[model samples]
Target: MTLYHFGNCVALVYVPYYLAYKHSGLSEYGAFWKCVQAGMIYMFTQLIKMMVLATFFPDNVEEFGSYLIGDFFKYTVDIADLVGLHFVLDGIPGKGHSKVLTAGIGWATAEVILSRALLLWVGARGAEFDWIYIQKCLESNILLVQHIATATLIWLRSRHNLNNNLKTVVTILLVLSCYKSLLFESLIHILKLGTWLGLVVKGAFTLAYGLFSLSIYAGMAELMGIY
Candidate 1:
């Protein structure tokens, strides 16, 4: 679950950065470097998510399921925890934890707005913002979204036709369906290993999954001509 969460985070951050860099008219190597920087920014964001989760919702962490709402809440809490941890970990008396708590609140507000904006981008053609509809859309379309976004960005960069929307959509759905049924399901069950491995195995798998997901996006980008 953690791995899946991490992978999604990496894809979210890296894909955008890659697109931005590609569009910026940067050389291939330069764009790759910029993407690397973006990955670092994403790592910082993930750290923020972890810190916030640890500080605020420490007790409810395990209960948080692997869904869009869960991701939103987790990331929001992470941002908050980053702020609070900065001050509290510094050991500056009462001012220590104060900063983090204050930061967490601010982070939550910002993220809520940003999340809405992202959803709008993803569901721009749709008319209402029903949570249930959005959830269904996410479950059904996330893989497609990832592939199309990556492919489109690359194709545009390479001055390609960008006329393969149908193919991209179909491919994503098929891949995600298989992924959910096989790999994702198996990975979820593997979480049981946490007991014997002291949770470190789970954390490692989460990170690896995140990286692998990012690579998939990268592959899509390359195939679509963005890379």
Candidate 2:
């Protein structure tokens, strides 16, 4: 899509979100401090994830050992992330949904910060980012919110699901875990292949994932009669 088209899409989504924010007085959730705490958890878990990946999943991208091997490791890291998020945020003080959103923002913020920092280190700013970089920024925000959506599922399970039905919680976490694992696995394929098809697939999957995340958020909001 063109930059203008994407901007319109973002605006369309933003308007209602802004309206809800105003009506709910959403700031009472203390998103900022909670985000800081969530960011810290993300950073810590990210470091551990990297260490584990490097130690076990190392450089399979260079060799042809990438497909099965990389996927296995990707699943490992995804599970680790789930464990970390559960460890830090489960049964905490705030409302389940609000806290999950802040935690997601915090996690997404760390990701964007570290990613752009690496780009700057490589002088990527010298490249044509006027349009591409803006798109990346927007894409990253979608992803960050996706993180929140995943956390929300997990949080809702912890708060209400298992207490209601074990089978339902298992199904939800499993589906979301596969969703998370697929994204990471696709990313590896993109990096290893470095082909146009790979790039296109990666971008396509990212957008699809973003829409899925937003849909879940909207579903949850409606389900709870929050809006």
Candidate 3:
């Protein structure tokens, strides 16, 4: 039974990534190694984030104000993800959509494997049943959407001929996406949200961002003749 449960969790977590790579036409481009390269960069970015946190933010605080200050700085470090994405986009060789999909999928896959694989291995295979593992799988799906939207926006921002107005909006959206967890944390604290409720809210947020990103991308593709 444990093995069965673990298999289900693994499928829930990973099968979408496989399906995405196969069906998104990235396979035809033979972009596998490119994605592997992006994933390696993702891991390196994470390692740097960890080292920075450990080196500079060594002390933990008990007070709420101090905690908030510390967390804000920690979240600031997440800006490195954009820098990492920039690097991922820089060297990728393909059309606009392919580059975006490759970078997004690779980055998200690396994150899920590094972050959730161990948790699923230990908890999902245990004799005890828990809804957290299931919730985590659902969360992973949302994260995948968020990452792809982020990649599209980053790629869009790179085109020098883009309208300044669109560039500004994209920059704002990128910052919002980067620090969305901080906003969600505040809302959860203020609203006293439950676990499942927070997940629902997060899904809603991801959906909104994704729709906006798609609209912007469509306009840009038409404008720039990226096809």
Best by lDDT: 3
| Cα displacement (Å) at residue 56, model 3 | 1.7
List the lowest-lDDT window of 10 residues for candidate 3.
56-65
Candidate 2 residue-wise lDDT, 37-139, digit = tens:
7668878888898888787765655453656656655665766667667765763466655666666555666666676545433433343334444444455
lDDT of 3 by residue, 134-226 (tens): 899989989999999999999989989888998999999998876789899989999999989999999999999999989989988898788
Report how far off residue 79 is in candidate 2 (Å). 1.5
Which structure among the candidates has the greatest TM-score?
3
Candidate 2 or 1, higher TM-score:
2
Instruction: Give me the runs in candidate 3 sitting further than 4 Å from their true place.
Output: 62-65
Instruction: Give per-residue lDDT, candidate 3, residue 148.
Output: 92
Steric collisions counted per model: 13, 0, 0
Candidates 1 and 3 compared: the better one by lDDT is 3
How does candidate 2 score on lDDT? 0.57
Clashing pairs in 3: none
> Candidate 1 overall Cα lDDT vs. reference?
0.38
- lDDT, model 1, position 28: 34
On the 0 to 100 scale, the lDDT of residue 164 in model 1 is: 70
lDDT-based ranking, best first?
3, 2, 1
TM-score of each: 0.24, 0.63, 0.96
